[model samples]
Target: MTPRSVPHPRGVRLVEGGADVAVYTESAEAVEFCRFDSDGNEHRTRLDQRTGHTFHGFVPDVEVGTRYGLRVHGPWDPANGLRFNPNKLLLDPYATAVEGGYDWGQPVFGHDMNNPDQLDESDSAGSVPRCVVTDRHSFDWGDDRPPRTPLAETIVYETHVKGFTQRFPGIDESLRGTYAGLAQPAAIEYLTDLGVTAVELLPVHQFVQDSHLGEKGLRNYWGYNSIGFLAPHNEYAAGGDGGQQVDEFKALVKALHAAGLEVILDVVYNHTAEGNHMGPTLALKGIDNASYYRLVPDDRAHYFDTTGTGNSLNVGHPAALTLIMDSLRYWVTEMHVDGFRFDLATTLTRQGGDADVHSAFLDLVAQDPTLAPIKMIAEPWDTAGYQVGGFPAEWSEWNGKFRDDVRDFWRSADSVLGTVSQRILGSPDVYEPTRRSPLCSVNFITAHDGFTLADLTSYDQKHNEANGEDNNDGESDNRSSNNGAEGPTDDPEINDRRNRQRRNFLATLLLSAGVPMILGGDEMGRTQGGNNNAYCQDDEISWFDWDAADQGLQEFTRMLIRLRRREPALRPEWYRRGPRDRSTPDRVQILRSDAKGFDPPDWNNPTARTITFVFHHDDADSFALLLNAAENGVEFTVPKAPGQEWRLELSSDDAQRVEGKVTTLILEGRSFTLLRSVTRKDVRGWARAHGYEVSSKGKVPRQVQQAFDDAHR
Candidate 1:
C-alpha cells in the first residue's frame, strides 16, 4: 500500500505486508492487476506507481497461491504492432508458475475475427491461465551442490521428462510421467549406470499443446512451444496446483544433483506459442505486441518470422532481452537448474539483420557472472541460416555436421570417409580458429527432432504419417538406411545387422573426441516405430517402452560410455594437432588399413573404408580403434610397440577376446574393434605374478577390475 517501498522484481514477490507484484510494459496506457477468488470472482486494482517501464503495486492481505492475471488497456492497432486489448486477460511474462491450460474455443483473440481491424470486446478470463503469487525462497536445498562436471568430461543424455518415465516399470504408477518420476531411485540408477554426467531434458518450461494438435487428437509431446519461461511445466508436477511446481522442480534438481547428474533444459526463447498476427493473444502479444515480437519492417501487420513458428520474439528490444535474461537467472538461482540448450539459437544472435557473435544477447551472457560459469549450449541454427560453429568461445554448440557425418559413414554413403575423420577428431576445421577445445562441439548422432538410434538403422525413410500430417511434416532426407529390409523383420541376419549398425553408431558417438550427447532411450533401443518426427505423437509412439526394452543394447551402450570415461585419449582437453613425437602426451595418430600414416591420396579414395585411430595418453591407458565399413572383411596390419603386446578390449562383431601374441587383425565388414597395449612382460608373466589366480581362461585379474571401477567412478 506504500508508494515509497522499493519495487519488487518481476512476477509475484511475497512481502511482509502482502505481495509486491511488478510487470514491465513500456507502451500500455493503463495496467490493471486482477486477482481471482476460489469462486472465480475477480477483483481489479489499478497500479498507481510507475518507475521507468515497470509498473508496480502492493496488495494488502493477499496470501500466497493467489491466482492473478493482467489486463492492459492500450491502442489496438495491429497494422503497427500495437495489439493491446483489455478484454483479454494476459498471463504475466514473469509468472513463476501457471495454473491452467489454454482453451482454443474461448474468445482469446485481441483482434476481432470478422473485422481484423477492430478490437474484440470478449473477455478471455476463463480461457487463459492465472499467474500465482510465489515464495521461491521457501525450498530447503540442504547443502545441494551442482555436479559442475567439466565440459570435456560431460556426456549429455537428451530425454523428455514425461516420456522418459511415463511407462517406466520401476517407477511408481502415481509418480510416472512427473518430475518426481525422474528423481526416482530407478531413474537415477539408470543414468548413473549409463555413465552420463548430465541430462538435457527436452523443454520443461511451461509450453502450449498447439490447438491444431488438439483438433487432430495429438499433443505436443516434445514441449517446444513454450509460453512461460520462468515457470516449470505444471503438468509435470505430481500433485498440488499453482506455485507447487516451484517446489517440485527444485526437489527434482536436488535429487539429480545428489546423484551427480546435471540438468540442462532445452529452452525455446526464440519464439512463443503465440503465432503470427492471426494467432491468439496470450501474454506478450496482448500486453505489448510491438515491443515483444519482431514485426515486418515495412509491414507491421506481419511478423519477421525466423523460427518458422509464425512469430519471433523481438530480442532486438531491450525489454525483450531483459525478459529472457530474467527468466534464465530465475531458473538458475531460484529453481537450481544447471544449464540451458537454446533451440534455434542463431535467431537470438541476429542484430541489425545479421547473426553477430557480439550480439547484445551473447554479450549479456558473456558478461553475466551467474550465467558465465554454467553450461551454455546452442542449437546454433535457425530456419533462416546455419551458424554451426559461429557461437563464441563461452558456449558449446550442437555439432550438426557431426550428426550428418556420423550418420553418413555408418550408412556407407560415398565420400564420407573424409568428413567422418574431421568430425570424430573434435572438428578442428570448425572450432580450431577460435582456440576452442573439443568440448566446444557437443557431438550427437540423434536428437529429439529426428529418428531414434534403432529407427535410424531400421528404416531408410521417416514414417511420420502417425503425426497426422500425411507424412509431409517431418524432414524428407533422413540420411538413414535399412540395410536389407524396412521396419521389423523376422530374418535373423537382417535383424542382426541392424543391431550391429546401431552399436557401431553408438560406439562412434561415445568414442569420438568431444562431448557426446546420447538420446535417452537409444541405449535401450527405444524406437518411435520409424516416426522420425514424433512431435505430436504423445501416445505410445513417443512414450519410452519399459517392458520390451533391449537390455543387451543398453548394456552395450553402458560399456561404451564407460570406455569413453576410462580412456583419457578418447576425450582430449585440447584439439589434437597430430603427434609431435611418439612419446608426446595425448598423441593422436590416424592410419590406413595397411598401417600407413594417413596419406593424402588415400584420404580421398572412395574405396578406402577401413581406418584406424591410435590415441595415446601418458596418464591413462591408451587405445586403438579400428573401423571397417566395406562389403568384405579386411586384414589390418597391427601396429607393434617395442616392448608391448596388443590386447583386444571390445569388438562390434562379437569377436572373442584374444590375449596371445598377435601380428595382424582381421575385422568383419562394417564392424569395429578396440585394442589396448600391455607390456610384453605383463602378458607373459601374468600367471606367475598372480600366483595361479590368473588361469588360462584369459580373464583379467582384480587389479584390472579395480582400474575399471576407478575409471567409471
Candidate 2:
C-alpha cells in the first residue's frame, strides 16, 4: 500500500498498524523521512504529499520506540537566505523526544566553514541527535490536577533540575540530577515547607550542549540554548531517553502537583541553538532557514538577532508562530505544566522589527484557549531593548526595575528612595498607566542570570574568570556590595553584615505588593563564588551544597514566606495608595521615621535612608514596616493607632520589644523590622456598643475595624 497523506498534527502520530508524520517547511523542495534501525542503518522514504507548507506521509510498521529524523532538500543560495543541505539530517521541529547529543563540529554545519556561501554536503546523521516517536499518552496521571495558584499569591522558586538535585543528599544515588530526583518525597517536602506556590524550573526543553563549552570541559547548566522545544531534555531523565524521558517529565509534573506545587517552565522561544550564518544545522536552520528565523532585510545572508543568541525566531511567519503555539499547548496539555516564564520574551514580539504590544505572537497567545488560563510571565526584555512593562495586560513581567531599585536602596545608592518606594508598592509608576494590577510586577532581588542572594551581599564585583572569559562576561555595575571584605572573609563583622543584608532583601521581596520569585537555594544561602553567570558551570559551582546550607537563613526565609502568606495586605491585587479621605482605611502609607507622612521633598531626599510603611487589609492583620539602610541606628517613633498597640513581630537585627504605651523603636543600621498591630480588649466593647458582633479574646473582625474607622472619620 502506498503511504497515505495527512497534515493536521505536525509531528509523528501513531495510527493503526503504522504512524503518520508531518513537518512544516515552506522552502523545502522535497522532504524525506529517515528512520534508523537498531544497528544505525538509515531507511529513507520521501514524503510525497503536501498541504499548504506542510509535507507529510504515513509509513507502515512505525512503532512507538522508533528513532527517526528528517532531511529537507532545498536551494543552497546563502545570499538570499537559503542554506539547506539534504546531506544534513535535521531533527523534527515538533519532535516530542530527541534521543542523542550533537558531535558539534564541521560535520554538523550546513555551510562549509572554509567557504560560507557553499554547502558542506556532509552527512550530519552520525553527529546530530535523532527524534524519537514517543507514546505521549502512556503516563498514568491518576487523579492529577493542576494547583492553578492565583498569580497574586504566587511565590516562584526559580531552580534548575540538575543543580537543585545534583547535590541533594535526600534522594538515592541513581536518581540524583534527574527528573525522578525532583519528584522524590524529600524534594517535594522541602518546597512545600518553604511555602513556595510554584517551581519555575530553568529550561527543560531539549537543548544542545554548547560546542565551545564542551571544548573547555564545561556544560550548559542553565539549558537556555533550546533545539527541540517540545521535548524534555533527555539527560534530565533517570529513565532511558528512547521514549522514557517524556514519561519521566510528566511524572515530575504529577508529583509536584500532588504536593500542591505548580511547575512553571522557563522557555526559550526567542531563538534555537543554531547560532548564526556560521552556526550548526542541528534543527531549524537545516530544515528551513528563511521561514523559521528573522533574516536581515538588506542582507538575507545574515540574521537580525535581537536575542543576542545569534538568531531570533521569525514571529511574523505563520510556521514559526504555529510551532511555538503548538509547543506551548503540548507542554500545558500533554506534559501538564502549570505555566511558562518566557525568557527574552520581547524578541518574540518584534514582528515589525520593533517590539509591539499587539504583535502577532502576543495576540496568538492571548487568544489561545489552552494557554489563556495558565499563568504567563515574560522576562520582558531582549539584548536590543528593555521592555519591562511592555507586555500585554494579561501577562506578568520579571520586574528589572524592582531588582535594580531594591538593590540600590539596600546598598544605600543616592536618590533611589522614591524609586524603591514605587517598587515596594508594586511599581505603580510602571504598571498603573497601563491599567495593570500590582501582580503585573514579579518582584525579585536576584535571579538565575545575576548574583545569587548570598553572593549579592558578599561580592562587590563579578568574579567570572572561572567561566573562561577572563572576567569579561556577565553584568557589571551589579549594584552589589561586599560589606567590608570580599568573598570568603573570616571577619565576623563583615559576615554578620552580609547575613543581615540577605534578610533585608528577603523581607522586602516577600512583604512587597506583587508576586515574589525566590532564586532557588537562596533561602539556604547558596553561592556561585561571585560568578554572576554560572550558566556553563554544571558541577560543584552550580549545585546546591546542602551540607553547608545556612539553616538560620533558611528559617528566616520561611518566616518571611509564612508572614507573606498570612497577610493579604502584602500581596494586593490592585495598586494601593494612602487613603484619599480620612474615612477610608489606608491600604498603604509611606512615612518618615518620625511617623509623619512623607512630603514631596522627603521622597526626593538623596540622603534619606530610613522609611516606614503602614499596611491595612480588610481581611488580615495590619502591619507597620520600618526600614533603615543607614550606617547608624535610628530611633523610629511608631505611628499611633487609638485601639491598637504595635507589637514587635520580626526583625533583621537583635530582637527588642516596646512596653506599654511606648511609641519609640530602635532599628539597627541596615536593618528592617515588621510590627503587628494588636487590638486592645476595649475595642471589642466599642464594637459591641456600635451594634457589630465582636469576639472578646481574638483578633478584631474586618467589619469591626471598618466601623471603628467610620466612627473616627
Candidate 3:
C-alpha cells in the first residue's frame, strides 16, 4: 500500500484502522519503520512521505501494543558529525512506552571498537530496547485536578520512588519499590501527615543502566541517564512495561493529586544515555546525530559536553528543541504531572558554548501557553558554570548558596553571619536585583545528590568509597561536621550534639522565607552510613529503614513543618525591608543578642555567633527566633513589647528552661528557639486590681506570679 503523508504529530498515534508514525531527521537519506511480531519476526516499511525534514508514513494494521523500532540510513561521515548506520535499530525519540533493556555490547555501538572512523555492520536489533505503541489518551482521569500549590506555600519533599517505598511497612511486598507503591494509601497518608505540599520525585524518564556499573554488580539507582523522554522508567512500573507503565504512572499522579499533593518531576533533558563518540547508537544518535547533539565547531567528531555527561543536547537546533518541548507537553497534558525540576538546566541555555539568558530554549518555555503556569525549577548549574539567579523571573532555582550558608552557620564557620542572614530572609541579595520574589529560591539544605541529613551531622568527611571511586566520587567540601565523633560513638555528649544539629538544620530550613525542600528520609534520621554519594547503592544504604527510624526526630520534623504552615510570618511572599515606621506592622528585624538592631559593623564581626529575628505580620501572631551557634550558652535579652509577653513555643534544646514572662533567656550553644508573642492583658489586669505592683515595661516578679496563681485558684 502507498504510505500516506503525515508530518504533524512526531510519534506514533492511534487512528481508526491503523497508526500514524512520524520521525524527524534532517540528515537521513531514508528512514524505515520496523515492527516486530510476538515470535520476533521483522517487517520493514519505508517512510516514503517527507515534508521539509520530517519523514512520516501510515501503517495500515498497526495497533496499540505493537513493538516497533526505527532505522535511519544516511551518510556515515564522522569528521563532519553525520553518524548513521542502518545496522542499528533505534528506539523512537517520542516513544511513550519502552520495553526491555540494553544488552550493552559492541553490537549496540554504531562505530567499530578498534577503528573510530569505520562503521560497524553488526545488527543491533537484539541489543537495544524496542518502543511499544500506546494509546496516549486512554487513561481514565476521573475528576482528577492538579493541586497547583502556590509557590510561597510550597514545601517540597525530594524523594526517590523505589527507595521511598521499597521497605515501607504499610504497602504490599509485591507493590513495594514501584509506581503503584507510592500511590498506595500508606505513602499518601504519610506525606499528608508530614505537611509537605509537593513531592519532587527524582528522574522517572526511561533510562539506560551504565554498563560499567553492571560489571561492578551495581545499578544506576538515581535514574539520571535517560533514553526515552516521553516514557516512564520500565523498572519503576509494577505492571509489565509493554504499555501498562503509562497507565500506572498516570494513576500515580492521579492518586497524589487526590490527596492534595503536587507531583513535580526531576526531569533530565540536558543529555541522553548515549555517551560521546564511543557511546551506543540508542535513539537520537542513530536517527540524526548531527542535529540532535551539540558538536564542536571545528571538531564535529567530538561533542561539547557541559553536563559532565558524555554529550549535551543541541538546544540551539529546531529539531532538538521540538523534541524537548513535545516531551514536556506530553508529561503535563497526557501524563498529568504538575511541574518539573530540570537537572543540569544550565546546559540547556548554552546556545554558543556560553550560557545565554535569551537562549531559544528559555524563550520557547517562557512564551509557551501550556507551560507558562507550570512550576518550572532549574538546577541552575552544570559542570561548566553556576547560574544561581541567572534564570528568568518566572522561574525558581535550587539555591546552592542557601544550602552552603545554612550549613556553615550551623557548623559555626566564621564570616558566615552575613550570608546566613541573607539566606534566612529568602536570599534577597541573590534575587532582589532580578526583581524576583522570595519564592524564586527553592531553599534546601540536603537533596538526592549530597549527604542525607543524618549523615551531614554525623560525618565531617565523605564515605563514598562504596561508589567504587576510591572515596573521591562525592564532594569533598560538604560543609559538614561530625560534632565530636567521626562515625557511631558511645559518647552521649557527641550524640546529643549531633541530634541538636539535625534539629537546627530542619528548623532553619522550614522557618526560612522561601520554598523549602526536605530530603525525604531526613525527617526520620535516615543515614547512609556516612556515604555522601550513594547513587550506585540501591540497597539499604539508600533505602529508608522504617524499623530503625528515629521517632523523636520524626516528631520534631513534623512539629517544625506544622509550625511553618501555621505561621504566616515565617514565609513571606516577597522580600520586605524594615517597616518605614514602627506602626507599619509588617516588617522583619534582625537583632543582636543585646536586643539592638544590627549595625553594618556588627554583621561583619566574625565573633558574632548569636542572632535573633523578629517577624511581625499584620494578620498573624508575631514571632521571634533566637539562634545561638557559639560554643557556650549565651544569655539573650528579649526585645521589649509594650502589651505582649513572649511565650516559648518550641526549642531545639530539650533541656532549655524558661519561666513565666521571661525577660532574659540563655540559649544553649548550637540551638534554635522559637517564641510567639501572647497578649498579657488578662494577667496584667489581674495583677493591677490585686495591688501586686507590677511594672508595665519590666518582668512581672515571682511574688506577683504567686499571688495571681493563688487568687485564681
lDDT of 3 by residue, 424-538 (tens): 9999899988788789999999999888998898888888888888997888855997899888899999999999999999999999998999999999999999998788998
lDDT of each: 0.84, 0.89, 0.90
Candidate 2 residue 500 C-alpha distance from true site, Å: 0.9
Cα lDDT of model 1 by residue, 396-425, tens digit? 999999999888887777777888988888
Candidate 1 TM-score to native: 0.94
Clash count per candidate: 0, 0, 0
After superposing candidate 1 on the true structure, give the runs of residues whose Cα lies further than 4 Å from its correct spot.
1-8, 577-586, 656-659, 679-713
Which parts of model 3 have CA positions greater than 4 angstroms off? 1-3, 577-586, 679-713
lDDT digits (tens) for residues 105-188 of candidate 2 = 889998888988888977888898889988888789999999989987889999999999998889998999999999999999
TM-score of each: 0.94, 0.95, 0.94
Tell me the lDDT of model 1 at 192. Answer: 93
Indicate the residue-level lDDT of 122 in model 3: 99
> Which parts of model 2 have CA positions greater than 4 angstroms off?
1-3, 577-584, 679-713
